[model samples]
Target: MNILILGSEEDIHAAHLKKSLTEKGITVDYLDTRLFPTKLKITWQAITHTGCLIFPDGRKWDLADINKIFWRTFGGVNVPKLTDSYQERIAVNDSMGLLRSFMRSQPEKWVNSWEAYEFHKEKPLQLSLANKIGVTIPATIITNNADEILEFSQAFKDVIFKPVYGGSHTQFLTKEHLEINRMKLALSISPVTIQEFIPGTNIRSYVIGEKVYSAEIRSSSLDFREDKRAKLIYLETPEDMKKQCLAITKAFGLKWTGIDWRFKPNGDFFFLEANFSPMFLHFERETGCPITEELIQLLTS
Candidate 1:
C-alpha cells in the first residue's frame, strides 16, 4: 500500500514518520503544502473524480492508487515575498481551497479525515460528547460577553481560558491578567472558552487503533507546553480510562489521537480534549513508545 503524508518539510514528526515508512519498504509520497502551486500540481478530472498529483521532480501519482493519507499538518501555501498583498492573499486562498477539495475527494483514505477533524476540533462539541460518554469534564463556558465571562469566573473562582477552536495555547487568567485586560475583553469580537482550573498531574494518552500508551507530564507552568522543567514518564493506562479513550477514538472515527486528561488530587481524571494530529515524536523519544511503528502498521494494514 502506498501512503501519502501531508505536512511541511520542516515538521520533525512528519520527517520521522516518512523515514519509518520508507524503512519498512513501503512507498511513501511526501507533500509539503507550503510548496503548492510552485512545486506541486493536481490534474483532476471532475467527471471521473480521478487525478494525478504531479511533483516538481517530474513524478506523478494517480489519486486512485493512493491507499492511505496521514495529514500531519495543513500548512499554508507559500506566496511570493515581493507581490501585491491583495493578490497574494487571493492566491493563498485559492490554493488552500483546491487542496481541501482534493483531500475531500478521497475522504476514506485518510487516517483522520478532514471532515472528522473539523467536527472534533470544536472544544464545546468534543467536551459534550466526552461528558455523554461518562467521562468527567471540568465546568466550562464559552462566551463573548464580558459580563457572562465575569460571572463564570466568579463562580469558578479560578478559571483558565483557551481558544474555542483548536491550535491556540491555553492560559490561566490570573486576577492581574484579567484586571489589566478587562477593557480589551469587552472589545473582543470572538467568543472564548473558559473552564474551571483543575489541579492535578497532566496525563497524555495516545490511542493508536486498539493500543493506548500514556505518559504523565510534570510541569510547574499552567500550560505544560511552555514549561521549561516539564518531564514525561510513561505509564500504563487504567483499564476503565482505556475503555473511555477507545470509545472517544471510535466516536470521532479517529484511527489515532492524543487525549489529554488531568488526574485530580481526589483520584478522578478530568477529560480535557483530544488532538487529531498530535506531535508524538517527543513522547516516543522520551518514553520509548512504539507509536511510529504502530502508525505504520495501521497505515499498511
Candidate 2:
C-alpha cells in the first residue's frame, strides 16, 4: 500500500513516521506543502478543482489521484517571495485556501482529517466534550472583560492563560509574548482563555490507535515549555489515567492525540488540553517506547 505524508521540512514527527513506514515495508512519499506547485489540476470522480500552489521552486503537483493524505501544520510551507511585494504575499495567502478545497474534495483515508481535527482546536469545545465524557477539566473562562479575569484569578489564585489559537513555538518572539503577557492578557485581540492552574505533576498522554503511552513532565517552574532552562522529569503514567487518555482521544474523534493532564495534591485530575498534533520524540526520549512503529502499523492496517 502507498501512504503520502504531508507536512513541512521541519516536521520531526513526519520524518520519524517516514523511517517507521520504511522499516514496515510500506511505500512512503513526502509532499512538503511549501514545495507544492502554483498551478495544478485534479479530476476526481465527476468533479474537478483547479488551482495554483506557490511551491518552493514554483513547481506544482496534480493531486487528484492520491490515495491517503496525512495532513499536518499548514504554515509549514516557507516559500520566499521572488519580488517581496504585497501582491506576491497575497498570492501565497490564497494558496492555502485552494489547498483546503482540494484536500476535502476526495473521500479517502485521512489521518484525522482536517475537518475532524479542527473541531477540537477550539479550547471551549474541547473542554465541553471532555466534561461530557466524564473527564475532569479545569475550570475555564474565555472572555475579554477585565473583571472576569480578576474574578477567576481571585477564585483560582494560580491561573495559567494561553492563546486560544497557538502559534509556532520555534519562534522566540511568540514565546516571549505569551510569557510576558501571562498576567494581563488585556492586549489580546481575541478572547483569552484562562484556567485555574492545577497543582501537582504534569503528564503528556499520547494515544496512537488503540495503544496509549503516558509521559510525566515534572518542572520546578510555572510552565514547563516556558522555562526550558529548568530541569524536567519524565515517566510513564499509571494504568487508570492511561485508559482515560484513550477515552479522551476517542471522545474527540482523534485517531492520534496528545493530552495534557495535571494531578492535584488531593489526587484529583484536571485536563489541561488535548493537542491534535503534538511532539512525540520527547516521549520516546523520556521513555524507550516505539511511537513511530505504532503509527506505521496503523497507517498500513
CA lDDT, every model vs. true structure: 0.86, 0.67
Pairs with backbone N, CA or C atoms under 3 Å apart (clashes), candidate 1 = none
Worst 10 residues of 2 by lDDT: 168-177
Query: Clashes in model 2: which pairs?
Result: 37-53, 37-59, 37-60, 38-52, 38-53
Candidate 1 residue lDDT tens string, 88-175: 8888888888888888888889988988778776779989998998888999888777767777888976799888985678888777
Question: How much is the lDDT of residue 45 in candidate 2?
Answer: 37
| Runs in model 2 lying further than 4 Å from the true structure | 39-67, 76-98, 106-108, 168-188, 229-236
Query: What lDDT score is found at residue 175 in candidate 1?
Result: 75
Residue 149 accuracy (lDDT) in model 1: 73
- Residue-level lDDT tens digits of model 2 in 64-126: 334466665654334457676887677666665555666666434677777666786687888
Query: How many residue pairs in model 2 have overlapping backbones?
Result: 5
State every prediction's TM-score relative to the real structure. 0.90, 0.78
> Which regions of candidate 1 deviate over 4 angstroms?
79-94, 166-169, 180-189
lDDT comparing candidate 2 with the true structure = 0.67
